[model samples]
Target: MHIESDQEGYRSCVNNSTSCQAYITYQALQDDTLQPVGLCFRLSVEQLAEALQIAQYLSVALDLFTSMDCELSSVTYIVGLKACRGLASEKESDKGLYLEKGITIHKGVKEHGFKTDIVVATNFLEMYSNCSSMHHAREVFESMFSQDAVAWNTLILGYVENGDYAVAMDLFSIMDCEPNCVTYLAALKACGGLASEPESEKQHHLQKGIGIHKKLQEGGFGSDIVVAITLVDMYGECGSMQNARDVFDRMIQCNAVTWTSLILGYVGNGQCSEAMDLFARMDCE
Candidate 1:
């Protein structure tokens, strides 16, 4: 049926495989059904794991990558890394397991000469980041063959996620490429993270946050709901209740999260009456 050449067949294979349990795929492998279906990326185990990723069967994909899969392609490494990242985000109880598997997959990727491949490398960086292994994540970023905005965002996000706010903002300043939404999001998060610093430090980041807000408005992202909400939150964290209200007023649409951000800004700054008034207004709206 030339499944490899048929686009519809390719899609069907992915859909079917995404629904597959590890045992089902394993049994299918044992039964040689893949030889005929021919659409799971030309019958490759790596492709099967890619399909499993769509269903977020992360552990199942890892099991195949670690054990049953004999042929390890670059895609297999990426799948393994992504699965490791997914697992890291799942259960706090298994933190060691996620980092260990991620490190192992990285070693295999290097051994197989895929360490320089951009996709594989970026996934490795993300896996390390999600595990909060910023030291390893920074090493991966530095070793990448090329650093695009996506890679830059991943590293910055890793620092922000790890509460290294100063380092995150420093990266934002020096990224070689233009920033994207993810970069801006990470930057705002860093600015927000500075709220607990001394007054001078907090005010310094507040100005930077304001600068970023202006850039977002110029870049036509000021009205982006997620960005606007985050901007509001950043201002709130910086004790700039009026700035938070300004961003709130500029948003084209306001969700509950958006409304709550501004209200919390007032409450956090000790403006109890303003918080109550804003909450009442939100209910009316």
Candidate 2:
């Protein structure tokens, strides 16, 4: 009875607090004050886990999952892994701690025999990707995969992030599904990365980047503001000011990234006056 009282008191304190309400309790999930938009939510553990993770109450969600007496499902594990990423990114000092915790959660999933489940494996891949744990991400990729683009894109993005640009492009080339915007972006980034290699690679990188640009247009993604901006960056990285300008000219809408990349391309090519002119236009626009 004493322990029950303390638990209730703790729940009450957390429920009333504005910023530090990080505790998890079944009763708390039912409280009127905490119901989202005033709707009663008698959420199951799985649903509450997802809800709490979406709300950025990451620690609270983990607590709820860990405290549950029933058998945990794959959805809960997926949400828990994502929450681990949230905590890892919430602070620079605490990143390593949460990454370690993510690995531990992966261990539990393996013990529960969900390791063979492709959807669970994909979320684990995403968690490892977010933490830039490429080694673990690769392991998850090899353990289970499908012909869908989502898993392939996540792994490709992971390689691009870790600066394994060659591997990134290779993965993109071998992907079974038609490349999507994310896949193209990662591949384009890989092409841009090659410009920093030996001078012998510059022409090759530029040509490959052009191919990607053509593909983007063919896929009707070239006009997208972000993709166009990345195209400008890829051109600048490959030392192709003309191609950069071509992309800029074709842009239906431009943002600071588009303008900045164009200006930087000029500056990189020793055309400081051209850069200044573009900067002036940017400032006005």
| CA lDDT of every candidate | 0.80, 0.76
TM-score of 1: 0.87
Which one is best on TM-score?
1
Query: What ranges in model 1 sit over 4 Å off?
Result: 1-15, 20-44
TM-score of each: 0.87, 0.81
**Model 2, which residues run further than 4 Å from truth?**
1-43, 145-147
Q: In model 2, which range of ten residues has the least summed lDDT?
A: 34-43
Q: For model 1, how does the per-residue alpha-carbon lDDT over 93-192 read when each residue is reduced to its tens digit?
A: 7867899989988888878898889888788778988898999999999998789998999899989988999999899999989898788889999999
